[model samples]
Target: MKALQLSAPKQWEQIEIDEPSPPGPGEALVRIHRVGVCGTDLGGYLGKFPFFSYPRIPGHELGVEVVAVGEGVENVKVGDRCSVEPYINCQKCYSCERGLTNCCESHQTLGVMCDGGLTEKMILPARKLHPANNLSYEQSALVETLAIGCHAIDRAHVTEKDTVLVIGSGPIGLSAIEFARVAGARVIVADLSQTRLDFVTEKMGMTDTIQFDGSEADIEKLEAMTDGRRADVVVDATGNHHSMRRAMEMAAFGGRVVYVGITQQDLQFPHAPFLHRRELTILASRNALTGDFARIIQLIESGVIDTDPWITHHAKFEEVIESFPAWTDPESGVVKAVIHIS
Candidate 1:
C-alpha cells in the first residue's frame, strides 16, 4: 500500500506501507477512489489548523468503493460506491445520545483527529458509508462538503420569503449558497474576490453580491440589497473573525445567523444593544448528520444540485504533494480541488 503522510508542517512524504487485514466487526474495508481537498486540509498543510497532529494522513472527504465487510456490517456491501463520513463520534456521549452526533462530546474526525483516507485503502465504520450509486466518483467526493451547507441551511430554516446572505465565496460558502437557493431564499453573496462574485452571479445565477470594502457602509450595502431591511438569514462561511463579526451587523431584526465557518480566536460581540435589541438567533452549524449526507447524495443524483462547476482543479494522488501549495493561493482561482486516488 502507498500513503502520503504529513510528517510536519509544510512537509509531506509518500511511503510504502503494509496493507491491513480484513475489516473488524462493524467495519468496512474500502478502496479509496477520490478525495476532496478542503479548507481544513489546506490549514493543516500550513501548520495552521488548531486540531491537527503531525505525521498524519490528511484526507477526510472520500469517495470510495466497498471491498469487503466485517462480521457485523449491514448497510453496505462489497463493490458499492460510497462517500465516507469522517466524523467518528462516541455514541455514548450526551450529544450523540440525543441524536446530535455531529457535536459528539468525543468526536474524532478522520484526517484531523486520526489517520484518514489519503491512501489507496482504508477501514471505516460500516454505518458511516453512504451509498452513492448514481453519482460519479468525483461527485461522490463532494457530498461531505455540500452536506456542511445543507446542515447550515437546515439550522436557519430558510424559506422563499427570506433573503439569505452568505459571506465568503469559497467552497464551503458556495455550498451554503446552493442549499439556500434550494430552500427558496433569494440568495445574496458577499466576498472580497471579483472572480468568485462573478461565479456566484454567472454560474450560480445569484443576482445580489456585496464586494466587501472594509467600510462601515458595508452593512448599509447589505441592507440596500435587501430593500433596506437587511437579510432574514445570514450564514457566515468566511471563518475569518472580521467577517464573522460583520455577519451580526448584516442580519435583519429578528433574523437568524448561522456560523458555518469556525475560528480559533474567542468570538466577542456587543451585548446590550447589538445582539439583544435585534432579538437575534445565533447558531453554530457544525458537521453534517447522516440525514444530510443522504439528502446531498439524492440532490446530486436527481440533478437538482449541479456541482460540476465546483471542481476547479484536479491532480492525481501521486501529484498532490507538489500541487497542493498552489491551490492554497487565491490567485489560482481554486474552488474545489479533487485528488484521484485509484
Candidate 2:
C-alpha cells in the first residue's frame, strides 16, 4: 500500500508500506475514500504543531468504507460508509470515565500522535467510526472538523438569545460559526484577512463581520453589533495568543469564552480585575465526543449545515506532496482541501 508521510518539516515522501492486518475483535478494516486537510495537518507540514512528530501519516478527517469488521462489531458492517472520530482515547482514563473522552489524560489523536488514514486502507477500533450513509465522501470527511466547533458550542452553552463572536475564519472558526448559527445565536465573525471576512459574509451568509487587527476600532465595531453590550459568548479559534487574550475583552459581563484552538506558546493574561469584575467563565475545548459526530452527521444529512461551498480545493493522493505547500499559502484561498485516496 502507498502512504504519504511527512519525513520532516517541508519534506513529503510517498512511501510503500506493508498492508495492514485484517480486523481483530472490536476492530474494523476501512478503505480510505477522502481525507480533509485541516490546520493540524498544515502546522505539522511546517513543523509548527507541538504534538506532531516527524515521519507521520497526517490525516484525521476521514471518509471511509468498511471493508471488513471483526466479531461483535455491530456498530459498522461491510460496505458501510462512515466518518471517523480520530481521537483515540483511553477508555479507563478519568476524563473518559466521566464521558469527557475528548480530553483524555493521555490522548493519541490520529495523524498527530499516531499514524492516520492517509493511505489506501487502515484498521481502526469499530467504535470510532460513525456511519454516515446519507452523506457523500466529501461531506462525511468534513464531519470531524465540524465536530470541533460543535463541541466548543456545547461547552459555551450558546443559546438563541446570546450573541456569539467567532474569531478566525479558518475551518475550525467556520465550524464554530456554523453550530452557533444552528443554536440560533446571532453570529459575528472576526478575522485579520479581509478576504476571509468577505468569504464568511458572502459565502456563509454572515452579515456581521469585523476586519480585526487588535485595534480598539475592532472592539468598537463588536460593541456596536451587540448594542454596546459586547458578545455574550466568544469562541477563539485563531490559536494565536494575542487573539486568545483579546477574546477576554470581546465578551460581555457574565459571558463565556471557549478556546477551541491549541497553541504551544505560553499565554499570559493581565486582566484579573476585569475577569473578577465580570464573573467570566473560561473554558478549554478539546476534541469532539461521539455525540458531536452523530449530531453533525445528522445536521449535514438534513441540509441544515451546507457542505457545498466548504471545499475550495482538491488533490489526489499522489499529488499531495506537490499540492500541500501551495494550499498552505493563504493566497490559495483554500477554505477546505480534500485528498481523494480512492
Predicted structure with the largest lDDT when compared to the true one: 2
- In angstroms, what RMSD does candidate 1 have relative to the true structure? 1.0
Tens digit per residue, CA lDDT, model 2, 175-281: 99999999999999999999999899889999989999788998999987788999899999998988898898899999999999988888878667557788899
Question: Each candidate: how many clashes?
Answer: 0, 0
Clashes of 2: 0
- Residue 210 deviation, candidate 2, in Å? 0.6
Provide the lowest-lDDT 10-residue window in model 1: 265-274
Candidate 2 lDDT trough over 10 residues, lowest sum: 267-276
Query: What is each predicted model's overall lDDT from 0 to 1?
Result: 0.90, 0.94
Q: What does candidate 1's lDDT look like per residue over 1-342, in tens digits?
A: 999989998899998878978899999999999999999999999987878998899899999999999997889999999988899998998899999999899999999989988899988899999999888989989999999999999999999999999999898999999999899889989998888999878888888898988788888888677778989899999888888887888888999999999888778888767689999999999999988998899999889999878998999988998899999999998999999998
Give the Cα error of residue 173 in candidate 2, in Å. 0.5
Steric clash count of candidate 1: 0
